[model samples]
Target: MKAFNIEDTAMILIDHQVGTNTWASTTPLELLQRNVIILAKFAKGTGMPTVLTSSQETNVNVQGPLMPELQEILPEEFAARIKRQGVVNAWDDENFANACRNTGKKNFVMAGVTTDVCMVAPAISALEEGFNVKVVCDACGSTNQIAEEMSWRRMERAGIGLTSTNAIVAELVKNWASTAGAIAFPLLT
Candidate 1:
């Protein structure tokens, strides 16, 4: 797959809710949160279309708000783009899927709370639907190490690209000589 072009890429954040994050033992919740913020800032600074979703908040048993750090980075106006889905796989929700499609971007960068379920499902679904998908592993987590590893393997075999938060930020910035780099370099480090 080609490198992410800022113009053609949309960042999709799924199930980064407090309740979902509390169950992640594969990666430190603090680190996962920080990476997520970095990605959000990258999208905001570069004007990349972004979609944020929280699953089953109203259902009894599943409940939580999006991480505060992630919410802070999003402008109040963009709140309309943040969808609350009833399904584990966000692509199953027409509102969430349409928000992404409306961006007119073919390349997608995804990061979510649960590596195996929330993250993997949408990444693969997007790929199957003809959207180029890149998973930001550092910004994602799983219930355990085994599930996380197995999910990554499955994603790789399905031809979905895996990348780090820093890589995605840097690739979008392009270079230190460019205007975006001048702003991004300080934030990335």
Candidate 2:
């Protein structure tokens, strides 16, 4: 496979609501939290443009914490590189889609809660649209191991690169000396 073109890459984070729950996971929720935070670190560290989306979060309160961290992570010195959208798929919402189109990227990087729906939907949509998509599997969780595995198989069939959060950091860093690599290694272990 050809190397990912980082400059043309965009990160899309879906439905990491503040109180979201994953029913079955070999990786604990805390680890999922840590992995996601580190994933954001990779995005900021690499200067990758990102789109953040949450669905029906108005009724639920599972989305929070990550926003403030991004500001500190990126330092926002190069203009805000992240956009928040009020959509489920993140690709289906017009604002999200427009934000993605505005990024001029061919690659979409993403992680989300409830891999069955939240993550799977946009990933499938993007893959169908001919976007080179990478779904960060480790950064997401499902109701159970069976669901997670099934979702993984579904994504794989779509020709999506189902990767881990650590792999995503590697994709962005491509070098250990980079700030992302330095920060990512400890958290992932």
**TM of each candidate vs. truth:** 0.92, 0.80
lDDT of 1 by residue, 1-189 (tens): 888888899988888887888777787988888788888887888888888888776553555777777657885524665556567788888888888888899999999889998888889888999999999998998988999999999999999999988888888778878877876777777
User: Any residue pairs clashing in model 2, and if so which?
Assistant: 17-62, 17-63, 18-62, 18-63, 19-62, 24-143
TM-score, prediction 1: 0.92
Q: Write the per-residue lDDT of candidate 2 for residues 34-78, one digit (tens) a residue.
A: 777787776765678877665664454454334345445545421
* Residue runs of model 1 more than 4 Å from their true location after superposition: 59-62
Whole-structure CA lDDT of model 1? 0.83
Task: Score each candidate by Cα lDDT.
Answer: 0.83, 0.70
Query: Best by TM-score, which number?
Result: 1
Off by over 4 Å in 2: 21-26, 61-88, 178-189
